[model samples]
Target: MNFFKPVAAVALGAALSASTAITAFAADTTLVISSWAPPTHGMNAKMWPKLTKMIEEATEGRVTAEIKYKLAPPPAQFDLIQDGAADLTWIFHGYNPGRFVATQLIELPGYQGSAEAASVAYWRAYEKYLKSANEHRGVKLVALHTHGPGQLHSSTKVTELDQIKGMKLRLGGGVSGAVGDALGATGIRVPAPKVYETLASNAADGVMMPMEGKKGFKLTEVAQHSYVMPGGFYRGSFALIMNQEKFESLSKADQDALMTVFGEPASRMAGQVWDEIDAIGVEATESTADNSLNTASEADRKAYDAIAAPIIEAAIKAATDKGVDAKAAVEFIASDMAAN
Candidate 1:
């Protein structure tokens, strides 16, 4: 009986040890995601949680994510992920100008119509044309998505190109600034967080951003006019990336699960969310009688396109210098957009 009791005690201890090990493994598998968008933005409200839930469900809860918001400013998001301050982050490619020259192909005017189409096209292009994963060395990119068309929101009515001449406008990043300059508007570089303050203080006459800005920044109260331009003049790309070390640390099963849900499918879902949010923004802007929305004239669009063409040419040249096949990439993107 004494020998039997010792054997039973050992078995019980082993069972408890196995249970503890399983629990530790479960706890360590949680993913940490950080984003600059507040909890209410479409990305935070509709997309991030949806993706996280999908990831968890796909892995049978073996993989989960804890999403933290506003961990840093929008521009610092990419670097934050690179340094492991965050396991994953959404990076606005335009925020880090010149760093993502190859990927900037998606930002050019007249290339995309719908977010869903563009998202898939961008992923396909990255795989087919830009084989240089070296650009994303040290980080694992999950998806590349872009916002809807950009429009002008101004304190004063801007119905034509001449109306914007000599006007100081708040621009998001380098491409926006370049577009603004090309259009003969004085482009003032201001971070998204500071746009409202600058607009209120008379430092800027207008801002060029997605329709979502009206809701995100409360532009309706400050800006009375929204000018829609032709040919999708301004759009920016966003990247969902994971830290290299964090990605490598995942077990093979977990990595496969993430890959199953992350790439084109995840991007398509996120892009649809942006499309829905963009419609909401337009509705919100139009709801107020104090605000006016107008589309640019054909002549105005033609004038702007003439200016933008050279910028696009220069961008292609810049990409060529960076070892990207500039002409082929441009032709590929254009043909893809045309086909889609």
Candidate 2:
């Protein structure tokens, strides 16, 4: 009787093991993406869905991704991916401070062109110059992009450049912090998700962000005025990253296929999404009652140019310290943007 019981137990264990293996083989590799933005934000609504579709098409549905929001705070995204808590995530370069210097190259002010052009230039520049920095050392970098030009959105009317002085503004770090300093504004550092509440509670007088914020974060309701500069005060740098081990564990064919859709392609798509959402933000501001958009006068533009030159020089120096010829890289980006 004891021998019969042992044999039955062994048979059941073998059957269960076979069942588990079959289940694993038949399932698609579902990548859990941790996102910090609200579900309605452009990053969540359009960009992530587009990326997931690209991944599915590239891998022929063998792999897929789903976004899981609020798994961690904004600044914690990189660490989350590194720890394998999430298979993928997008991170704003300026959020972490001191951890991303070369990335500042893309965030510097005075780059002309739409976000799409600048983003393509960014990926090209990364290949030629910024890759040496290894700033994103722990994860697999899927894409790099910049948002539309950063402008001022305020709860109170801001008609002149000089009016920014002493106002507490939410600055998303990198060159934006320096720009705020140059304008004599007091800077409040916060993740993008917190900006709405910060402004709603009067914790900040204004926020410097891309136009997408007008709709993406519902800034149109709280921040009723926008002070726009032709090229904007600055741009925000962002990167889409995946867990290195997770990327490598994929079948080699799938890895190569995913690469075809990542990098430049992904960057371009993200930028296009930014362009779309920026337009939406502009429309929202225009259609919303009592909201106003004011462009800087030519005099303010000239003065801002002067203020921006020194900040640009400082960013170049910072990138140069990372062993990148940032001046050349900047020129390359400009010329490339112009070409577009």
Best by lDDT: 2
- Worst ten-residue run, lDDT, model 1? 128-137
lDDT per residue as tens, model 1, 246-299: 888888888898899878888888788888888888888999888988998989
Superposition-based RMSD of candidate 2 using all C-alpha atoms, in angstroms: 8.1
Residue pairs with colliding backbones in model 2 are none
Q: What is the C-alpha local distance difference test score of each model? A: 0.80, 0.94
lDDT (10s digit) by residue, model 2, range 175-262: 9999999999999999999999999999999999999999999998889899999988999999999999999999999999999998
lDDT of 2: 0.94
What TM-score should be assigned to candidate 2?
A: 0.92
**lDDT, model 2, position 148:** 99
